[model samples]
Target: MEHPVLIAIRRAAFTPLGWFAPGPADHAPENAKFLILIGNTGPEMFRRFARESGVATKLDAWTREAVSGLAADLGATAVYPFDTDPPWPFLSWARRGGAGHVSPLGLNIHSVYGLWHAYRAALLFPVVFDLTPPSPGSHPCETCVGRPCLSACPVGAFDGAGYDVQACAKHLAREEGQACMARGCLARHACPVGQGFAYAPAQASYHMRAFLGARQEE
Candidate 1:
């Protein structure tokens, strides 16, 4: 008998409120029977959930376990992670080697959340779905010559190598980041896509403070 577990996992992971809030792309699993969407809850949330689950010792391990469990239940062949180093093989292929460009909407062109979206877990099935991967030829950033995101930073937190987590946090800790603290995040909002995904200023400041450990001025 095929694994009924795979179906159960699919239902849980792809549901409207499932881990992956919105589905990304559809892929064919060589052995699995279903597909699961792992939602983005940010890095901290991922760690907390993993620790509580007790199946993983590290963030990556915990995520893998979560997706695997879902796939196993659904009789799927494999589970995949969307974020972190080196994207999934199929996703990479679909991206047509343009993985270096950050997505504008915080979601991958194939996904609704863009770069802001992340996968805490994944589940794959053996069955084939009528899903069509996004065209790897389309480049969203091609027309974005100004790169507002790079300029919107009050402290130039993004140094092209990666975000200066310390610098960003420190600035947000003080009154200088008041604008962002009162209204909404600047850098995230600067992106052309996923305007709705912008974090509220207070929320951004809270994250900045946590990352930088910067003390607020009295």
Candidate 2:
């Protein structure tokens, strides 16, 4: 039988990437014993997103409505990476969830999806779900010495030590940046892991636009 969470999100084209029990520091939902990290593995979810909304704007809003409903039905609470004046510590939770690792590009890399996957929302349950904790896979970046992801950025936005947001944004706004804008981050594209799960061009372009837009507003 499908895991309850899997079944609930399947129609929406989401999946349980991995999960973990929340500790005191996790600031988990009140009485939340488990937090199931919800996300996508490839471009498939983007197809559903496009088909349903026609327009790709306000994905967080659409996600809130969809996943929140699922949470309610499961008697759980939903939280998102995009939440609030005080953003929830989703990156920390993801690290603990066993599927995510620190990547040179400052985005979480997954063993199976590498740079292409993304966390959409998480369902926090008061009662623990019947799911086994996943074993943390060896960090893919460890074995890859050349680390092409760091060198592929046109503006050298990622310097291993930190990410230069201004440098990245400035480049993305320029006419010459059109290639990256229409595709995705050059650094992300350079990651050798999980090439098979790379996002479809349309999906990648959508996210690239979204990232640039958010940076412009800041």
Name the runs in model 2 displaced over 4 angstroms. Answer: none
For model 2, residues 74-166, the per-residue Cα lDDT tens digits are: 788888988885788888888888867989778999877888888998888887777778765889999997999999998999998899988
Look at candidate 2 and tell me the lDDT of residue 59. Answer: 77
Error of 1 at 195 (Å): 1.4
Model 2 worst lDDT window (10 residues): 52-61
* lDDT for each residue of candidate 1 in 1-218, tens digit (9 for 90 to 100): 32344345434433211211123343333444444444443333433443476322444555566656655655554445644353554444324323223454233432333344444444554554444423334455666677677678899877545767567667766888767665545766676754554444434544444344434332
Best by lDDT: 2
> How many backbone overlaps does candidate 1 show?
27
